[model samples]
Target: MSRNKGGRPPKNEGQKIKQAHLRLTEDQHKKLMQLEDQIGLNRTDLFIKRVLENQDFIITKDVLIQLAKVGAEMGKVGSNINQLAKHANTIIKNHQLPPEIVAQYNDLLGLHLVQERELYKVLRQMYRVMKN
Candidate 1:
């Protein structure tokens, strides 16, 4: 009988739950932002990858471009789902919908899965780079 309370899920007891806040100089912030935008990682993740995990690796522009494409495709998929839901609601006001709704849902789900696969491949490539 697991139930969510509608907020953030509880964290494990032993997890790394601490947070840090830092202020950097203008030049330092600029350099960090450049790496963040180019590598598709935020400051915390970049620090973890470089300092904590010690997985220093160079990421080319191609990887970032591929990630951007995956992200754009995901946005389009979400828009399509929202439009389908709106149309279905308009047609099924106080009535049962037909089976095509399930088909539409499945199609959207399949599209999202394909995009996830692409994202996974990019992550795998990054992992391979890290292992070297």
Candidate 2:
């Protein structure tokens, strides 16, 4: 029986209300109830607000694809480093090379491996930010 400022009944009341049932884990339900209390609204009102304001939600597909590509490149880099390490290990096992050469190869492998790891960390951080 709510009336608008113009003394007319609200147009929306006559509209049909749709009901839906959802299941959630106990922890999730508790969190939802806490969010409702924090927002001064029930869960239904919160869902409505979320639907209305979903423009703020981010689902960056392109960024995700780019991250996948970066991951693939990182994997290739890792594979290359792995092959190099295996080759060096084989040489060490064969003992065909001088100690100084083996030491140099080990140093080079360590540098490349560390650089690859750092690059992977950066890529992971970028992916997290984009996906969040």
TM-scores for every candidate against the unseen true structure: 0.40, 0.38
- After superposition on all CA atoms, how large is the RMSD of candidate 1? 16.2
lDDT of 1 by residue, 1-132 (tens): 996669877898968689888799999999989888887777877887788777767675766687689778878878887897888888789788887876888787888789778877878987687565
Top-lDDT structure, candidate number: 1
lDDT of 1 at 98: 83
Candidate 1 residues lying further than 4 Å off, grouped into runs, are 1-58, 94-96, 114-121, 124-132
**lDDT of candidate model 1 versus the reference:** 0.79
| Candidate 2 lDDT (Cα, 0 to 1) | 0.69
Cα error, candidate 2, residue 125 (Å): 3.4
Best by TM-score: 1
Candidate 2 weakest lDDT stretch, 10 residues: 52-61
Note the Cα lDDT for every prediction shown: 0.79, 0.69
TM-score of 1: 0.40
What RMSD does each model have against the real structure? 16.2, 13.4
Query: In model 2, which residue pairs have backbone atoms overlapping below 3 Å?
Result: none
Question: Candidate 1, residue 116: CA error in Å?
Answer: 2.3
* Residue range 1-132, candidate 2, lDDT tens digits: 995567756568647478867899999999988766654656665675566455233334555577689778868877886887788789878977677876887787789778778977876676554453
